[model samples]
Target: MTAPQRARSAQPALDRVDRRILDHLADHGRSSIADLAEAVSISASSAQRRLRRLESEEVVRGYRAVLDPIAVDRGLVVHLAVTLVDHTTNTVGRFERHVLDLAGLVSCHHVTGDVDYLMRVDVADVEALDVLLRRTLARLPGVARLTTMVATSAVVDRVTQV
Candidate 1:
């Protein structure tokens, strides 16, 4: 974990006020303590106290600016469904370790079902995708097969809403 990231405590029961604070912060990440207090109908000091508690408890991880993929030259998004040769701990560990070296990796999930892992990758175009598939993904340890799906469009996600 990074310096500001703490290991989360056992799921803390959230009250209505906490939920409201989180819901407000989800859409307005840059809200100041005063703004957050006003939005949540709490005192600034209470907002500060609660926000600090949330951060220390790891419920509020950290703030980051969400960037547009096209603005960053990564206009194409591809889903890679990866099937490993086996489910041995060693095989899974090695495969996951290798995936960390891959560039343009937006997210990776080790999931159940036919595929062992699903990775979301962003690239400039098909040629870049081809390079990633042939040069990087194929060479990952214990990778038995890969299925690719190119996304035509992205749907908006409301991730942190209560």
Candidate 2:
């Protein structure tokens, strides 16, 4: 099956309350149910039920602590444009599997345009990036070429939709 088909089949639709809970979490993951209820304008019990339902449905995957990459010493942020030599299902699958296994690859999106894939990568330095390119990315089966753009500043990186 295609990637989009596989993703859609795995994930279920979100209800209104579920969406509100998700939005609340996206804005502030540590927000209590009482606060969340106040924000969503629902009773505390109702908010609890909605949050439980969202969790059970996998709509609310898991909560995580967002950290500063630079503070943690992972200073380099690279956006990579990856073009595959082949677009067949097998080739795409192989590339996807390999990309998923790579440690420095933060996010990978199968995108349209000249490039087949867009990858967000993070590393300690340029040396680490070189190692990632040579040892990890280059070893992938169908990768034809990769072009990288390093981010100098983060203008906006919002987790929640507004």
On residues 2-42, what C-alpha lDDT tens digit does candidate 2 reach at each position? 99999999887777767777878887888898999998889
Q: Model 1: per-residue lDDT, tens digit, 63-94?
A: 87767666776778889999999999999999
Residue pairs clashing in model 1 are none
| Angstrom error at residue 137, model 2 | 2.0
Runs in model 2 deviating more than 4 A are: 1-18, 159-162
**What is candidate 1's TM-score against the reference?**
0.86
By lDDT, who's the top model here? 1
Compute each candidate's TM-score over C-alphas.
Answer: 0.86, 0.81
lDDT (CA) per prediction: 0.87, 0.84
Off by over 4 Å in 1: 1-9, 158-162
